[model samples]
Target chain A: MNINILYAALAPIVAILLGLLYIGIGRKIIARLQRRYGPPFYQQYIDTIKLLAKKTVSSHGVFFSLGPIMGLAGSMVTLLFIPFGSAAPLLSFHGDIILVMYLVVIAPLGMALGVGEGSNPNGSIGMARGLTLMLAYEVPFVLALFSVVLYTHTTSIAQIVQSQAGEWSLLKFHGFNWLTFALPISAIVADICLQGMLGEKPFDQVIAPHEIASGPMVEYGGKYLGMMVINHALHIYIETALFVDIFLGGGPVWFFIPATFSVFILSLIINGVLPRFRIGQALKFYWGVPLILAVIGIIYTMVVIK
Target chain B: MKQKTEQKKSLNQGGKNMTEEKSIDFFEYFIGPQHPGITGNFGVILNAVGDEIIKAQANPGYLHRAFEKLMEQRMYLQNVPLVCRICVPEPDVNEALYSMAIETLTGIEVPERAKYIRTIVLEMARLAAYLFYFGGTAATLGLYTLPNWSFGDRDYILDLFEELTGARIYHIYMQPGGVRRDLPKDFTKKLYSLLQTLKKRIKEYDGIFFDAALFKKRTKGVGVINKDMAIEYSVTGPNLRASGIAYDIRKDTPYLAYPDINFNVITENEGDFYSRVMVRRREFEEDIKILEQLIDKLPSGEVWNRYPMPLNWKVEKGDVYVKVESTKGEYGYYVVSDGSEKPRRIHVRGPSMTHGIMLLEKLLKGQRIADISPIMFSLDICPPDIDR
Candidate 1:
């Protein structure tokens, strides 16, 4: 059986559908937390369809149209690199985790480029904040990844998952996970950074609906928004899947739904109960407590934990 | 750092750039007739050099309905409904002040029991408005949960209002001499319970919103108004109080039953955004305390004065001004009668006319663009107040 050909065609469609479903469910969950009768679980699909059905607007230029497509493509390619539990990476390589980290950026860069072309100052402000926040959170997140990679001695996510088969990474040795517990600080930092990475509340300055008019998405309408929405959905899945894989052991493809949901709910609850940080405050916080935690976790892993 | 120096050089270029800011590095963003952070049909034209706002022009009149001029055409009693629409968050202050001014003009003394009832409704209205202000200010800092919770909590207050006045938002219950009706049966008992629920919820809110790390970080040192500036701008209500003045219309110039009701004048020194918000939070407790006093000592008697409020009600040729401590600040009304059915003039001085426009323009200059909403919300600017 030729797995490459099979996955190339099927994976993106399946991933996209699953991504949309997750987003739909996520909205319902957050809505319930606020004690409102939320929109239907399939609301994202309906919203996307509605957006697509609307008449197109005059584009700022060729770049504006290219932005969404490029963003979607960047995410799709990143999705292919992330292994779905037991399944091999669609394009596996020795240091694909690093590649995944850098590739994840392409989507936002695409959005930034599109926003730049639109010439909205608010969008530029929002993009600047987003990029600044990205710098803030990425450090701790990368440090957490480094802790795991150094401990496991493998940069490939597939190899890391395979190594965890005898015992899930969270409960590797007699219900005591070295990476999570021995240096609990790293895991805690990762959890906090994940909130920012997913663009939830408290860290949702970029999509600030009131402040800057949904920031970069202000001018987008019809198919442009639809493209961004689908891209957003895929972005959610990729990030959450990455978190689950690194910490919770992505497990078999069968456990993917439940595992991904647990992480989603955790992120959702954190998002629901808190107020937002100004971009400056968010930067200061990321560099303050979380950065210290990541540093301590890395030292512990290097000196003793591993 | 580089951009600042470059912008400085460009600013020095000063020829065509001075004539048109559009040609310069600066750009403008219209934050509202429909912005989420905006209060009613208002907007702010923010000119920015990078993320910092250089100038902010307060845009009002989008929600204007000329209530002052409208009052001139309507009968004395008829204008009561129109004045309440001036500030939507706490309409009772307008109602109370309008009624007081009219009472002074007509030389009609309100019944003692009606005064007590009016006092209770006013306190409840204050609580309702504070709840709204808290929720709204939190929303500006990106706390959606607080609004969801606070708005839900406010409905409990509204439910109480509906039970007493038969209307939720625009009660239109207060007339020239007194309120439209007596308290509903068991209304006092229900209010007692609602206060307890609110007290508990306020504590929970403290944990989730007020005490949250991000909120403190976002608000602290952000929109500081000095005592001198506060007085200069006539920034009344909690905003002025936040700048260290313990002045309150309820305490300073008592009306209705407030002269008898003892309460603390909540004040703060720093007058920063957080101080303004905390002042409102403390005032929430004070409002509840005042309501409790009104409930405990409520007189059981007639709730209206002995004047038939005919549609064509007339008053003598006299003018009087009355001010009430509203949720936003000192809401005032001046009414003049020409011994006819209609009033000669009626003027409203809403606190937001000062806070939302002139003070906002001052506070916004040189501040980060993100702080505009917080500063506006913390000041408790009701755009309808300005627009009206």
Candidate 2:
């Protein structure tokens, strides 16, 4: 068997496993914050198994069922470009970061299509909200990433990680020399954008439980919900992993996962306490404050950090 | 978009000017018998064009159990339990109203201490209902934490009710004359500590919910029931008070132990959603004050009146109307006796029947879908009250 083929096969399973761990840990942390006994750290795995084992699995047709599959595939494909530790990714290229960014959108677009055709108005409304939020948050996020690509003078995520090797990034565990230390404003804006990306509270109007009945997941049940849950876990892993790779710098296998989990924990704690932001307010904040921060960071990178 | 607008314009021209074929889209939004924003098994049908609500019809029959007709069938003494069911969140007000009406018809004098006890129970119910109101209103705006905290704190109040009346939601403690039982010997001390806990909790609520920037943006200027409209629609409770009206049955009519008790009749000038909820929030403080005064001036005597409400007790045929200041609003009860064991007629004037249907429908027009739940909850439109 080819070495690349072996990695390609193992990557998705590893991503799924990591996704489940992150979700389970995230829920436990949020539960502890709420001062209540939460589910066990392995609860997401059990829930996933239970959902897959559900007796009454319903679907609105083939395309509706295709949504989660597309999402899972997208998550897997996006992970191919992102390196974990010193090990080479399943697929890496000169400008894999741009490809990964575009690939990230395909999953949500796929889910939106499924949710639209499912004929649940709540889901459609949620899809609409999600897409609109996507437009708003993407501007600052792309700007922030574009600035990094320009400053690093490379489009490859692996090269970007390697550029920040040694004491160049803060996560190097030696001095305050990192992308965040130079352009903290961009990192801040990226964190806010990450909230929108994760579909968590304050920015969670897309899945507003009271407003639209969990939004796009309203019609999703049984196996589809299980798939959705898996997609959600993969989403958390991919996003936090992306954050870790881009800002915190990819590291040796020993230190990278913990660093990624720490960033996710910070986001989770913030999500647990804050009330959801109305879509309009969320849009305004993204376009207003974070946009400014991204612009400032881009300028600083161009003039100073370079 | 142009064609649709032109189509709308042509339709406005009595369909005579229709020259082009076009399709117009409208949404018929049915907001829950199962929705979280709904206080109970309640639903609203909103006729909307785009996100704007064109017509909102309040549906009230989902929770109907026919409490008035049920009350008419049962004897006056036996009707206590039935009246409490009329409003689920706070039942003591109904119990008090029923008792007061019977007291008036029979000319029974409640002991001073019994009056004080009834007042304490009413205040406790008010506090519980307000806490529920806070939870519902905040939850409508996507503040999930407040509901948990407020409801958790309200359990202490419910615990007090359970200790006093042996029930929580439907505390049928007040009888035709006074109360069903005496204090639990440590109720005042327990109540004082509970009040202190609640007082501390209110600051937390203010920080997280009431004073929240997002909450203010969501609620402010959303549902404004103007002074004249409030009066015309017969809106009562915190809703009416929030609309700049100072009318309260407890203060104006001076019922139960209210005439002797000291507390402010909380009011706000803005007839909007925020004002209405804030009025209830302030009233929660006033209820604590009233409870504190009731404890200080609690005379040691009979909790229940000496008058025996026999199973076969009969009175000279008469009708009486009695109203009380409940947490929701003025909860009024009317009774007519035909010199029989069972009352000939019983009618309830629930506050929600006015605020829920008439005012809710009227306010919802031209508002966004996001504003619907906030407006409904800020009105504190309990569906059971409307259904009953």
- Kindly list the per-residue Cα lDDT of model 1 for residues B230-312, writing each as its tens digit: 98888898899999998988888888998888899989999999999999898888788888888899988888885556675
Q: Ten-residue segment with the worst summed lDDT in candidate 1 chain A?
A: A169-178
Query: B1-388 in candidate 2: lDDT tens per residue?
Result: 3464455333322311222343545556667766776888777877667567888988657777888888777877888878888888988888888888888998998989999998888888889989999988887787677887888888989998899889878887888778888899799999999999899989989988888887787777878989999999988878899999998888888987888887788899989988998999988888889999999999988766655557877866999888887777878888898998889888898888888888889999988776788888888888898888
Question: Which residue pairs overlap in candidate 1's backbone?
Answer: B237-B329
Clashes of 1: 1
DockQ for all candidate structures vs. native: 0.49, 0.34
Clashes per candidate (backbone, < 3 Å) = 1, 3
Per-residue CA lDDT of candidate 1, range A171-200, in tens? 443323324654577778998998998899
For model 2, the superposed segments whose C-alpha errors exceed 4 Å read A167-172, B1-23, B306-309
